[model samples]
Target: MCLSFHSFRKLIASVLFLTFFFTGCKNSEKRTVKTEEITFIKEGELSIYKPGTDVPVLNLNIELAETDYETQTGLMYRTSMKENEAMLFIFDDVAMHSFYMKNTEFPLDILFIKEDMTIGSFQENAQPLDEGSLSSKVPVQYVLEVNAGIVAEKGLSIGDSISFQKL
Candidate 1:
């Protein structure tokens, strides 16, 4: 069948419109994947332990993961985290490393930890996107994650120390 120029232009426009509509919806869907509310305690206090340390009490909600899988997965796929809840990623040895918000819907404050439980560096209010890497300025063995901006709100800063304890 032979088509007139006007009809062909109309068909092209329709195809472009549908393509944009579907693409927008797909992007929105991906954004919500990690936006669901997570069931974590907010009103309770938890302790953090600095392995092989003799310092005083180090009260923190996040705890170190003792297993390899837990350390590797860290906090991936978490939709939401409570204000008082956190995740501490531990490594067997101090090394250069980085983290990203891949698959993480909410923004976070990432604290790179040294072997002595001191914060090497921290990145606050990190954006969620694939292939975004937040790295430590120095070699570190532990990392802590909390709700975005909590670090500054709590008056925590570089050179301020952190320690952990067994619960």
Candidate 2:
């Protein structure tokens, strides 16, 4: 069929518009994967011992986040942490520490430890994805994040001490 310039241009534009519109709708359709799968992270082990003695209670595989960037992004997108796993945050000075659970996918129990190696405070069973700040009532140099309820399961207390070695 012979067509004029205007009809040809309009046909071409209509075809392009329909192609893009259908393509966009297809991309927006429900995806097969409901949630993004996250990989588990393990870097080392941290042993939590008795309050004052060296007697060991339990050892947790841990991922250490020492630098400023790592500390800021701690466990934000993880789907879960093993019962025997934890994340440790190290800082230079003993100061009040605060934590929030934005983008976190699972609950955690945060342990705040003083420079002298004693547990100074705890934020237990912190809900996942919460932005509320969890605090160390006293100044602390280290912070530990573990699967929620691990502390109570092991009967951990305020004075419990930890010893860790990197893998």
Residue range 1-167, candidate 1, lDDT tens digits: 98899999999999999999999999988885445644543333344434444542335576455488766656677777777678877788899879888777788898888897787899999876555788988999988888898777766666656655445
Q: Candidate 1 deviates by what RMSD? A: 8.2
Q: List the residue pairs that clash in candidate 2.
A: none
Could you tell me every candidate's TM-score relative to the true structure? 0.64, 0.82
Which ranges in model 2 have alpha carbons more than 4 Å from their true place?
A: 1-20, 28-38
Give the range where candidate 2 is weakest over 10 consecutive residues by summed lDDT: 30-39
Best-fitting candidate, scored by TM-score: 2
What lDDT would candidate 1 get against the real structure? 0.73
Candidate 1 is scored at a TM of 0.64
